[model samples]
Target: MVPEPSSEAPAKSFTDIQTRNGSIYTHPGLLSLPPSSGTSSSSGKRHRFSIIVPESVTDQIILKCKAIASGTSVTHVFIAALAMALSELQPPKEESYAVRYVNHSMINLRPYCRAPYNTREHAAAPYHTVSAQALGIDLVVPGPPIDGKDDGQINELSQVATQVRDYFRTVRPTSSQDEQIAVSPLMFKSLTTPPGSDPHIVSDPPFCPAVISSLGNIGSIVSASHGPFELTNVWAASEPIGAGVAIFLGTWNGRIELSGVFDTRYHDSGYIRKFLERMLDSVSGGLDVDNCTAPIRVTPNEEK
Candidate 1:
């Protein structure tokens, strides 16, 4: 299940995680349950991912996401829409998304899960292992995104919320002595297709479909005015698995954006772009939301 920030204690404060580097000692119990070292039979893979924000900041590019292709909440919306679209275009290995995380054994012996976006401080290791099921049917959009969408329309927020809930239902931590440990430095990729020595097929698939994290959403960071550093949004993602692509999201234009990064070995970014564009166009045009839907649009650019 996606880890929620503790309301009881203040969040860890940091000057600059990128610059400062040191390994802090965490409890031993934290590492008791070893994380799935990208080695599993079923290979969980998360398909869609997103974050919800306000429409006001939809166009503002802060530190992370730049430009407003869509509006606030659009990121989260896009993820849901994109996920649904992908489901139709390329059905995932499993219906549930495989959301990854930086397991911090020190924070609570379990793993300190990163927030969805950039936060106040950039301390502590930002890499660990944890996952949540990205499935379900009810999104509680905080702002405008919730105003006009169809009453029963299951947006990304709703879907992700459901996925989070389901994650808790399935797994439960045995202890709380876990602390900060095993920080994911820059990036992590999933083995989408099962690894093999074959000829025409992918060697590795993602252990999970989606990897959701809260690396950038530090409340203090979000509120502070760091000179020219405008805290626009945050995002997290990993490499692709099998023939499928990788997904990432952060605060873009004040809302969440669904971004994809795939391994060129399986397919080219152009193919993924074409597929996503067509998919977005299909769902956006079909969205019957009266007022809540953000200005959903797809771009025709490749990451390379």
Candidate 2:
């Protein structure tokens, strides 16, 4: 039987979940868009791309990261890699020298659901309860010109992954109140309002530079369908909120797929493409920290 939703609050205060000074980390480019451009009509456009991560690679990363080995899933590793890549893509201000980037990940709450509600039938139901919540995490890494040694890069990635895992374990929601806080109507209203217009929302930052969400492994569940069919690939995309970027990931049949959404008004196709490439490179342990200069654009005619 499905259980009633809990009315109890979490042990910790909801406000405590946010990272102090998180707004400072948001990419300046995203926030700098003209006020008029912040409208949904302007920022609603989205561009998407996908890449596959072999199961072996995912397993290796999990083994190497002690945090993941302890309990967390591979999603933490991807978030860390993405944070690092974005820090590289968007350099810090010359004066501050802070490579602060804030991102939120959507956590699946099906496991938290009680009894029959946790079953596939209920989860797949057209009108399931709010089975997901967005949890925020901020990444602050050293600005560029650091040593590009292979060992250094690996160590950095590992450290970031560890931080992500720790944050998820501690700061993320632990009770129904936490979930309620995450999906609050106020938060939704804040996101729709332009920054600074609403003093309340401005004081509490609603958007970040990027948002990452993972659908996890769904091959088994999908394969359980009535007919005989194979799910070869899966991808997802959503309009960026407030000129920011949205990254969606899903693992199916031992392969992980990544898709990104961005606003053309704030970013071009080439820029978005290069960013994804760098993110994939970071995850695959092929990114050269020293050579992450801006990507060169080549038109179709120029390709010849």
Candidate 3:
């Protein structure tokens, strides 16, 4: 007897991703339209992401992350959340080196769009970016993700970036402003979502916090420079937890590098070394892709 033909069809290529949108819940980053109650906006626009990372990854969870990035594009974060909390939980009377600094970028939509608006539609709306650096000051209070609550405190690292986005959102007609500043309301009303792969899937890796190599990934669109912008390079101090950070970087061969900062006392270079090794081992074990220890085509600095 002949065997029955297989009933399953082949998986669709990436081109078919749009069909899956309805089945997939909204991306974690993008804010839902109508916002949440008092937080709603007249523009009907919201953010794609509020904060990064689901919550603190437990040790077991860390193991799974190691499996993915070990030998693949994924890289494991070496720092532990507990240690980061401890540094803030118990601060020293004297100043300590356990602090983190971050530089973020924002887009100046004014230059690109002659009108003020908030729709995802204007595909041609050019963007001008700005970068701002912030240092973690005294840990006046415990941060969220500690108690497992997402709140304003959790957003401190991103305050500067958010402010920049708001700046573009609220640009209004003013007498002092030139006719060039007189944006069109129709442009704003026509705002619609852009066409592309879902922002959620094209995940970028996080930055390594403790050591600031020239190539480390960091920055947000709201804070990124617009033109012949000078590169802003800043070293992040470690947190009490570990010496590592994470970033969602642009192309590896691009003009800019993004990075995140961590307090070394919380995270250390040694932890990063171990994390990187484990990551390589984990990826090799799971995927039949490659061994990352190829001849270093790029020098250590270049890898950064």
Candidate 4:
């Protein structure tokens, strides 16, 4: 039987880790730029699209990543794949001005909430009345094409995946309740501050090139029946917040869905579609994985 989820607060060691890495918000290079000065009215809003990864393919990806990177998980592989896709789609031209892709992933704090506040049962509770919280952490990775010939595709992805895994392992918060609460005020302050004043008031700039949020396994959540209710599909979407792109990953009924939110000012619908297709192709062995040595082609998907 599955054990009940823990409601304990994070430990002291965990809080220490969070405090040390809090600089993510203030990193100068990670700061975002305001929407272009000559922006058109249409450029003000965000757009969204989605792609589904069948369970079979997801399983294959998991097996492949682990075989190549030892203990790396699917999320690490996916993030590495995303970094690769972004690099392919927008290769930086200048040697000195390459883009350093940064991904901010949401970390759920539900498990650390005290007592009754620990479970999703209190999701409807008012923000001020509940102890639930969530935090975002930056995962920085190299982007832009290398100058030399490409190495074996599988080996390359594995190397990237290992780097991703090591980065997360080093920076992830240590489990501690007090530390989680201590950081809440900072997150709140950052959220309440005006965008125009964020740079001046907040020491850390809130700039992320890309964001990834996983909702974990939702099969059980939907499986809970209510008066003969039956569920079919499950997915989630969100507005593009401060980032050029955001991708939400969720699993239900054994399938994983990737919902990508993009700022139309930066990328169009066609580009988003092609980006998703390329991402799928990269993981599903469409790209030559055994011995290919050239950068993966990133052709746009043709409109019907």
Candidate 5:
């Protein structure tokens, strides 16, 4: 959670994320996750911002964290990092919030969907399930000098990672895989349906605000070129369904990437840029906590 919102002012932070170039800490309203299926009636422009992480960093974190404990994957650490970033940054309000619980949703149904339904050909949709009620508060955000070996930053991050890992591990489906194929037409359309509609489906833990799918080593699937059209790069994003935002993660070429999509109508771009910088800072710091002894400034090699 946050230390406290200052009496002076705040840097745009969030109950939600900022715009591609916009800030999420503007209006004083619901920064709900698994945003309401219906598009926001309040209009605003949308913007996208993205950054790539070095492959070296990804590999190191994976190797080190994997050795820390069972189920301590790099994905777990990244979730901790995301929670840390969200807590530290201020949402756009007259006064920022003192974070208590992080309202986040994580959804990936591809593995659960069967056959043609799983592929994009049949419109493999993403869902947003939100609960105004906050979830558990076991996550801990690491503080300064994260690179210092004596501060226990790594241990703290590791604990947070473990908590996240355990949560998913414990909640992983106990039922057979076939039971998960409940994505009926009503359930699927309900994601984008307005509240007035009747779709009596209830999603446990609700859909997450974030939908991250690892696009492992992109070079594996993509061909070098298609006829005369050469393929140099690929960028992807799962935009916010309602007034909120969504982030995507993957590895391409030699770098890991993060892309955030938000509407400029609700967020301010300048502030969002600052927010993104802080997030990258947290990610780099957390990843390097176990490697380098001295602190270092990691720069973005590419952008989206």
Candidate 6:
């Protein structure tokens, strides 16, 4: 498993989260999308965009993240980059300190289930974990510089990313996790077949959601030439539900490829494009890997 998400957030915490939605404040205009009929991914109303991060940049980000903590992984790098993008797109409001964001990642249960059920691909459960200081205004703007460079942002990014890493690291295999995997099929059925005007979900929709799912290193599972076929490219996406977008990422052939999709009802293609652009922009930095310290991160190329 490259990385899987933690348990779903509690409803009590969710109530507190809505009161402080950072994503909404960061880009209020983005939510005012064009009128759309499509409501879900299955409704044929999803827009998409893809990103292929340079291998060098990917390695740099990964290394910098590891400096934050020995346990930090690629997923944490993305999470930090995501927090940066959300913050950079718009300045935070005066009350931005209350803003929050939720990360929704699915848990692949094949490793936990028995041989007969292990083969099931949909044997996964959704996990929504909220952060206390997501996209915090103080994380970036008006921050001190490190070594005459904006390494302050780097340190901040690492802090944000490491928090997520630590949260997941604390999770262990539990009976609840096993139960969620077992009932995943019923959850899937609920998605396709709504109970009524309001569909019942296994968990509440995430607040200021950043739904990220990593397919890990696809190169490990897929080969370029299999039998008589040559694989040139592979594309995949899981469309957004509710009000946020979903990002599906995988590393292939030394490059980290990412695809993000959102329902038109909640977003415009341009909005999604801009959102992803900001995200990749945060990742595609030209920083000296050598300049980075365990407590400091290299600044983005534009900043330098």
Q: Which ranges in model 5 have alpha carbons more than 4 Å from their true place?
A: 1-43, 90-98, 101-155, 171-192, 195-217, 289-304
State residue 107's C-alpha deviation in candidate 4, in Å.
1.8
Best by TM-score: 4
Worst 10 residues of 2 by lDDT: 295-304
- Write down the TM-score of every candidate: 0.38, 0.62, 0.23, 0.63, 0.57, 0.60
lDDT ranking of the models: 4, 6, 2, 5, 1, 3
- Give the range of the ten consecutive residues with the poorest summed lDDT in model 6: 295-304
The lDDT values for all models are 0.35, 0.51, 0.28, 0.52, 0.47, 0.51
lDDT of 4 by residue, 114-222 (tens): 6566656776422321122322223333333466633222225566677777766644545533444445444444447575654322123223356666666778656
Q: Which pairs, if any, clash in model 4? A: 9-177, 10-175, 10-176, 10-177, 11-175, 11-176, 14-174, 25-204, 26-204
Among all windows of 10 consecutive residues in model 4, the one with the lowest summed lDDT is 291-300
Give the winner by TM-score: 5 or 6: 6
Candidate 2: where is the Cα deviation over 4 Å?
1-12, 15-44, 54-59, 62-69, 92-96, 111-119, 123-155, 171-208, 224-228, 286-304
RMSD in Å for all candidates: 15.0, 7.9, 21.4, 8.2, 13.7, 10.1
Question: Candidate 6: lDDT of 154?
Answer: 39
Q: Can you write out model 1's per-residue Cα lDDT over 62-162, one digit (the tens) per residue?
A: 31121222222333344445444433433223123322221211122224344532232545534344321112322222222335553343334334423
User: Candidate 6: where is the Cα deviation over 4 Å?
Assistant: 1-44, 94-96, 119-155, 172-194, 198-208, 284-304
TM-score of 2: 0.62
Runs in model 1 with CA error above 4 Å? Answer: 1-83, 90-122, 132-164, 168-225, 228-237, 277-287, 290-304
Report how far off residue 230 is in candidate 2 (Å).
3.1
On lDDT, the stronger of 4 and 6 is 4
